[model samples]
Target: MTISRRILLASPVLAMATPASAQGDWPSRTIRIIVPAPGGAGTADNLARIFAQEMEKRLPQRVIIENRGGAAGNVGATAAARAAPDGYTILWTWAGTMATNPAMYSDMPFDPQRDFVPVVLLGSVPNILIVNNDFPAQSLAEFTAYAKANPGAINHGTTGNGSSMHLAAELYGQRSGTRLTHVPYAAPAAATTDLIAGRIQAMFNLVTGAQPLVTGGRARALAVLSPERVPQLPDVPTAAELGMPGLAFGTWFCLMLPRGADPAIVSRLNALANEVLADPEARRRLEGAGMALDGGGTPERLAQYLREEMASHAELVRISGAKVN
Candidate 1:
């Protein structure tokens, strides 16, 4: 056969092999998933580790996590956004970092929509209206009645302005015609500690984080700020069921790739995430930890979810007057 004929035959084969070869070689080294929160029990960090462990089982490469926690998740998000979009580096973050931060802060380092491509929404934890066991109110009715009588006398603790807790309380106040005095804390732990000490009257805490407090008799959940009751706290009725359907709030998390990541890698990781979340053991652990797993949708869904959350949170910020800056 002529050399030209041989080259033509080889061209198509090379094209096909090149893509396969690239996909195979992609994870040649360790893959790192960046958790934009603290490690050692931080929800995002813990969740990231779960996925990383499962991803390692599937991929030939090792999957590791790097916790870059600080500045309300902006520090880590910025780092991930600036990293090369070659799939080796990724960002596993939550609503606070992507949706709330942009609305809260005027000087954000990265644009969530422009700088990252979503892989999937991991899950969410509902914010529960928790109060110290010593507080007078027992139900939403009693709570709102007490707040209305007291006006801004009730001190509600939050991590900071525009945090899930703060905005949730603000939303409740807006809908219920009651008022709360916002007290900011450096972290949720501190706020919870203060609540336990009776230094704060109430807080909108994540169901998982508030579980032990409720069970231990340190605090009690008045209502779960979700449309439906969560498995973590099955006994707690949803705000909707309590006749305040609009008083819903929660934080969702997602896996995101730095912008321009390989489409093949996005698909592969999204598939792996779905598999990991679907695992009986993983699901049990995550659900037990307060997450409602929703891991299988397309990346586009996550992107759309992010947009919707941004708009919602922007309105929350407006109503709550929450400004981190």
Candidate 2:
């Protein structure tokens, strides 16, 4: 598969019909996965499209992806939250939408916990520390020391205030006891351009976004803020290996249903999701794109994970002071 084709699905289902099939032949018609982001090349859209593409091949009914982008995912999330609680409408989103947006925006339209039912976690992409090759630091250890020595010398580019990228950078700074000036961008592509042109000294870029640059020699990857090394960039060290376990940062993707979805349908979808996620090809493609398919499949696990992530993101947002409105 091509690099774009090998990436993870919209963020990240289905099984058969013992009990869930009884629900008026659930999924008798088209099932739509609502991706709360713009369509095209980004992680949110590609992940959703490819995921649905794979599932569509097996499902008896058609599986389609719907893009609803704006307001940093609030627009699409609200649309999902308001959608009918039928089995057909599934919300495909990530930690930024489900976990961090609440902390960033004051008038969030939907409560991630209250308005939706957890379906399954798709995957996660860790934020790896990358610096311009021209910068002084060559390794994570040296980078931290340099940041400490020159508190405001480093300029770290991020997608925007309170974005997953910004939060990861804040977490890294907090854990490393170093300071960095924030250079927030409207999008990661622009920030990436700036990083390459020496406009910014560093970035806590997602592994998917950072891998090619590191491999192409545009940037030097120092450490991944994850528990383990990603398949796409195995040569980079992890934060734990660098003795900075507290810097662990990742943006996990998940699937959810609008509130009031039928229990039987939920069960059916969850089962199918588990089966699809466990497939070796799915794992290979997702992992190859720097996404780890280690997300817990059960709804109970997803709920607990959401709660934990929300709490962690809240703290990080407070520390970063990245309010959206």
Candidate 3:
């Protein structure tokens, strides 16, 4: 038979095996991942880097990260949601963005529940309540006493309303039964600058953002909002250890693709991501940036976790009255 006639005869066999074969080695093209934050060596950026490095080794093509930062991550997320649902474009962002942004703005371009599919849960880190070294309170106990005595007299800086730092400080005040004025900023760097200048008395800052301030001696490390003390900062105690256990919460970043992405493709990407999270060298860089490796489960588990967190954060906002508008 002629070559064309033979190929036509074999077409049925090729079609039957295509689905099974694709599952064996998916991601046959370059993947573009997006970060909904500024371009920097921040915690979330570091995570995207680590994952990209490991994923590039196993996949047929490379993974790239595009930083699209604005409106506290809404811009990038919206862009990712609008991209093709071919599993090539992924969005990796902090859990706070997923949980808090809906409450901040009246309209969002993408629906967190409907537009995306979870890949995995990255590790979590706690925020640090820091003050300029010149401030009087030396410890969590002392700080609480001072704040209680001077309710609303102390002003604290947060990334913005509905940000993790804002909710954290609000939760700290409510749980400790203290009052402090809030001053919101567009970015953490600005808040850090003001905290260093002693314009603000204190701030609930992410460990990554506060590391330089504390090391530079511009800010005092009071208490961390974690269940236990972090290994890196063994000297600093957790808020629970200092009598504010309820203030403890870990901020996390997670990987997600557009909804309706092929299951085979998602599985391939998830496997590579887990391999990345398990790498020791990668883990070190991420941990230094204040993130932990959370390579534990299937996408279903992460989806459930997201739902529960949404409810939990909603209650937190309701009780704290921490609305952005």
Candidate 4:
């Protein structure tokens, strides 16, 4: 049988799967995955590379990642949104691009729901509450008591005003009924530097980024901002476990295709992605980097998750009064 015919027949149940002719020898050439974030050791970039590497092993064609970071992931997201609906180009972005950006930015470049179709939820990483070694608070309880007693005396640093880290901290303060000051930095690295120097008393940074500081003893991890403790920081308790279930928050990465992509391609890509994520090695690598593996079931499930997250983040933006035009 022809390659196209075989792919079409690969799944008999997915009647909506695009016919071979529609996709036109799908994946005939190299595929590009656009990361709507900076090119660095950040979770998004690292995870994208890992996904690409794993995908390469399964697919016949090469998969390449392009970094187009700027404007809180707006630049790359918009580019991906406007790209041809063909499956060749897909977007690999996180909560900032799909959920937070909608509520945080007034002039959003792309409407995530309208512009793209969810392919899979790559994984999630919780933000750990880290404080300088010199800080008196060694645990979440201690920090809460200290902050409540001195309300506003403790200052926390975040990547930016509306960044995920900022929201995580804000959410914590709101739930815990503490009034901590926010000190926005140009980037997490800058914030980390200030944190080590004791310029800021606390921060809720991604575990992947904050792990080194905690491990090196430059900072102390008080708690993880998730329902469950991460394997990377086995000793640290989750916010939920520490009596602040409402403080559960984290950044989740996902893959999406421009809207109107061929159904067959979507199904094929989703299956391939699930296969990659299910690989023990892939899970180990991602988890070691502080990622919580997400069981990527289907495009519809991902879309529902995105919708729920957007609503939650919208509420956060409203309460925090974070806006960027």
C-alpha lDDT score of every prediction, in listed order: 0.81, 0.82, 0.74, 0.82
- List where candidate 3 sits over 4 angstroms from the true fold: 1-22, 320-325
Which segments of candidate 1 are over 4 A away from where they belong? 1-21
TM match of model 3 to true structure:
0.88
Model 4: runs farther than 4 Å from truth? 1-24
Error of 1 at 71 (Å): 1.1
Clashing pairs in 3: none
Clashes (N, CA, C under 3 Å) per candidate: 0, 8, 0, 1
User: C-alpha displacement of 93 in model 4, angstroms?
Assistant: 0.7
lDDT of 4 by residue, 1-325 (tens): 0001111111122333234225547788899999987787688888888889889999889999999999989999999988887888999988877888899888887898878877877778878899999999877999999999998999899988778788897788889888889899987889999999998999889888888898888999999887777787889898878887777778888889887788878888999999988999987877776678854777776776777788878988888888897
lDDT of 3 by residue, 222-323 (tens): 987776666666788888788776777657778887776666767776777777777787778777767745434566656666676677677667766766
Report the error of model 1 at residue 277, Å. 1.9
- Candidate 1 per-residue lDDT, tens place, 57-170, comes to 888889889989888899999999998877889798888899889998989999998888778777887789999889999998899999999999889998888888888888
Mind giving the per-residue lDDT tens digits that candidate 2 earns over 1-325? 0011122333212222233234667878999998888887787687777778777877888998899999888899999989877788899999889889999999889999889888887778788899998998888889989999999899999988888778988888888888999999988999999999999999998888999999999999999888878778888988889898677787788889887777677877788888878888876766766677777456776776777788889999999888888
Candidate 3, residue 235: the lDDT equals 82
